[model samples]
Target: MIRIVSLLLVGLLLSCDEDVLPKPNSFLRLEYEKATYKSFDDKEYPFSFQYSKDAKVIEKKKYWLDIYYPNLNATLVLSYMHVKGNLMFLLKDAEKLTFKHMIKADDIQAVPYENTQSKVYGKIFEVYGNAATQIQFHATDSVSNFMTGALYFYAKPNYDSIMPAVHYLKKDIVRLMETIEWKKEEYF
Candidate 1:
């Protein structure tokens, strides 16, 4: 009787099996350090603004610069063009360049900026999706100076993986536009 009762208890304990459950999908959380800004005032350019201290500014040529974010693997290209009495044309070209991404982009929203005191007027484009470039903008005093900037990621344009970086840099871009005031063109 003792042997039979012990065997039955062992069998009952072994039969109490839990069912295997599937887990929900997991996502990779990438965190970046908080950004700090500093004045980017260089005599080489007609305008100056604040940029993230986290990025390295590379001067490609006179009035042409690249703000590179090493940790995010992205670069902001600032290319300057003389207005030459064609402000409308230049504005059209900038819009066209950004629109080219519409094929791959989910949507594009334009945010207009005007600083009457600084005499700066421009539009910042926020692009959504896996497009090659995410943000683009044009800042001009609307006379002698016309400058356009575009943000590109060195890594493939995977929007999901790069969304955090995009949002982080968006603030920097807004700061840049806010502080980008035109200087009196130095006449030689």
Candidate 2:
């Protein structure tokens, strides 16, 4: 009886030697394929630009388009407006749209872009944190054309989870801003 009790005590003591710990939370690892770009030139639209081939462009209206990324579950919403003496208002509206996310955004960085030769001037707004839109930009010819784009994901705005996708699409946005060309000026 004594030997059995000693063995049971030893077993209990050994079992308590280490405090069991819950495993650390594991994060999902996401990987995406390299992006290939293609030019989008339509005679109907005032501007033309390049976009990722992985995306499908859907024309919403005469001047609006939705660039859908099926793999990333995101969309780049593009709207082209005729700048008829209301360039300031158009630009102000674009900036207003970006700042609307300020409540949820941790930071908003405005990066200016100017291509004097191409006559494409714009500002790209990078919104950091779990905001509704991760990126927003506007390109204009300062004469007759204005274009604004916003990047949105289908999933809930979890900045960390969607950061990889945001980074990928951001390159596409920059490319679009860089390659945008205004066909001609048709002032009203």
Across 1-188, the per-residue lDDT of candidate 1 in tens digits comes to 99999999999889989976899899988777777898888886778888999999999988889999988889999998877889999999999999999999999999999999988899999999999999999999988888899999998898988898899899889898888877777821
TM-score for each prediction? 0.86, 0.86
Model 2, range 1-188, lDDT digits (tens) per residue? 99999999999988896788999999888787887899999887778899999999999998899999998899999998987899999999999999999999999999999999999999999999999999999999998899999999999999998998898899999999999989866523
Global lDDT of each candidate: 0.90, 0.93
Please report the TM-score between candidate 2 and the true structure.
0.86
Query: How does model 2 fare in lDDT?
Result: 0.93
Q: In candidate 1, residue 179 scores what lDDT? A: 88
Q: Alpha carbon lDDT of residue 108, candidate 1? A: 99
lDDT of 1 at 188: 15
